[model samples]
Target: MQIIMSGLIMGCIYGLAALGLVLIYKTTMVVNFAQGEMAMLTTFISFGLLTKYNFSYFVSFTGALIVSLILGAVIYAVFMNRVQAADHLNQIVITLGLFLIINGVAGLLWGHQPESFPTPFSDKVIPIGSALITRNDIFIFIFTLLLMGVLYVLFNFTKIGLAMRASAQDLTASRLMGIKVPLVFMSTWAIGTVLGSVAGMMTAPLTFLSPTMMFDILIMAFASAVLGGFVYMPGVIIGGLIIGVFGNVVSYYYSPEMKVVYTFLLIIIILYIRPQGIFGGKQTVKKV
Candidate 1:
């Protein structure tokens, strides 16, 4: 039960992070290698707001999300927009460059030390059958579920969401339909960044705040996204949960160090058996 609970908590975090990556890919066709670093940077911003300015946790959280929105817009306007017409490799290289730059900036600003992040949730341990878990764990689960619910409503019942979907499916057609494709693209990045920030802030308390802290989680997030069919948004969550449970089960039964190895092995096996991923749909072939 303990291992299962741990996996679910961590899986929610991975799902949020993977959502950001998949969002960018769906809209801009770019695999954002910088997603984790961007999240780390925003998480540090929240840390600074909490520690340096002594803001309340709620205020710091709101401030960090606002910063994330602006950062995402600026990045898209100044960097990603310029490479929009480039080939896939060029676009990917730009994201990789962003990954490096964000990491360096985070290290320089926050230094190399890991710090304990404060959370509003109580640290008191609670018993669940034979397993013990912190209140924070339960809070994290509730928070993630609420967040996903909000996203579902936004995407399903909002005009901006409709525009984003149109833009993702057919950018040229969206423009012809007067959808302001550029604005949609910018909004997509902003939304994705905000999601990433939420994941980062939640994860910091579990894993300590540091520049390199998100790298490992990022790997799992990538695995999750790929496993779920990178273009499918909701499937990312399922993929994350699967990866998380698989990792935890492996760790419990085998060596903890072998968990990551086996997780990737699982990915390879799953992909080999079902190349389109668990939820990936049929691909459309465009014949010349």
Candidate 2:
């Protein structure tokens, strides 16, 4: 139960990150290879605000999120939207280029050293049977759940969400039907970055703030997305939870070094059997 509990929290973070990835892919058919770096950048932004400017965590965090929102929209409008109709290879290359540039810029600005990030919760824990529940863990778990619920409401109840869904379903039809496809896609990117930024800020205290802070989380998040059927919103979170438990079990029973290897191996096995993902619908290519 201890390992499970710990892994559950970790999985929530993975799911949260993967949610951002899925949102962009679902809307624009672009796999953001730079998603992690983008999140890392935002975390650094918050870190700088809190440490250098002496801003409160809440204000700094909100400020970082706002930056992420604008960053997402601007990136799409300036770079990605122009190539929306380009080849998949082009999109992939662009995102990969973004990943490198963002990581490099963060390194130049923040240097290579890892910095500590403050958390709202102290390093305290409560023991429950065999499990030790830390305040940070509880915060992460609850916050992730609440944020995901907000996403649920956004996707199902909001006008923008409905338009986004329609755009995802059929971009041409949506445009023909008077849905602002560009606006929907731009909003998707913006919201996706917001999600990623939140995940990064929450995770930084645990892993420390650095240019590479989101690397492991990003990998696990991708694994989670793939395992849950990359396009299935709800199943992605469950997949992340499963990954958390499974990865932690391996780390505990074997070695931490093998955790990623095991994760990749699991993904390979799953893909071999289910190319469309466990919860994803039939694989179909649609122009963005």
Candidate 3:
């Protein structure tokens, strides 16, 4: 139970991170390698708001999210949109550049020292089957579920979601259907960044805040996305959970240092057997 809970907690954060990756890819056809950096930067924003500006927690949270929204939108408008027609290599390079730039700015602003993140939940621990877990663990799991629910509803039932879906499915068709493709795409990036920021904020409370804080999370998030398949949102999320649990279990039974190496080994082995990922090779399209 202890192992399971620990893995789930980490998995939830990873899944959130991966979800942001998949979200942009599905709509924009570009993998934002800088997703983690954006998360890290927004987290720093929240921390500064809380620590330096002496703002309330809620204000800091909202302020960070608002900054994330603008950050996403501006990146899309100024950078991603221009590269949308470029080769994948160019897009990847651009995102990597963004990653470097963001990381550098964060370091200059916040330094590399780790600082404790304020936890929103109580520190009380509860036991289940002789295994103890904190309120934050439960909160992470519950929050992830609720967020997924909201996303599911947004993707399935709303006009904006439908437009976004159409844009993802067929960009030219979306334009012909009178949808403002760029606007939809801009919104997608905005939403994707917001998602990543949430993941970043959630992660800080679990570990500590630093400029390089998201390095490990980014690697694990890609692993989760690869494991679950890139296009399937639910699949990537489940993949994250699997990665989290498997990594935790391996660390518990084997070596903590090799957990990441072993986790990728698992992903590679699975890919060897099924190259399309656990959830790949099948694209589900909703026809209206």
Q: How well does model 2 score by local distance difference test? A: 0.92
Weakest 10 consecutive residues of candidate 3 by summed lDDT: 279-288
> What are the clash counts of all predictions, listed in order?
0, 0, 0
- How big is the positional error of residue 136 in model 1, measured in Å on the Cα after superposition? 1.4
Regions of model 3 farther than 4 Å from truth: 283-288
- Decide which is better by TM-score, 1 or 3: 1
> How do the residues 1-288 of candidate 3 rate in per-residue lDDT, one tens digit apiece?
889889988999999999999999999899999999999999999998999999987799999999999999999999999989899999999999999999999889888999999977789999989689988788789989998998999999999899999998888899999999889989999999998898999899988999888999999999999999988999999999999999999999999999999999999999999988998886666778
Which one wins on TM-score?
1
Please state every model's RMSD to the true fold in angstroms. 1.2, 1.6, 2.6
Candidate 1 lDDT over 1-288, as tens digits, reads 889889988998999999998988888888888988999999999999999999999999999999999999999999999988899999999999999999998888879999999987777899999888888888878888887888888888999989988987777789899898778889989989998888999899998999998998899999999899988878998899888888999999998999889999999999999998889988886655
Candidate 2, position 253, lDDT: 100
lDDT (Cα, 0-100) at 12 in candidate 2 = 90
Clashing pairs in 2: none
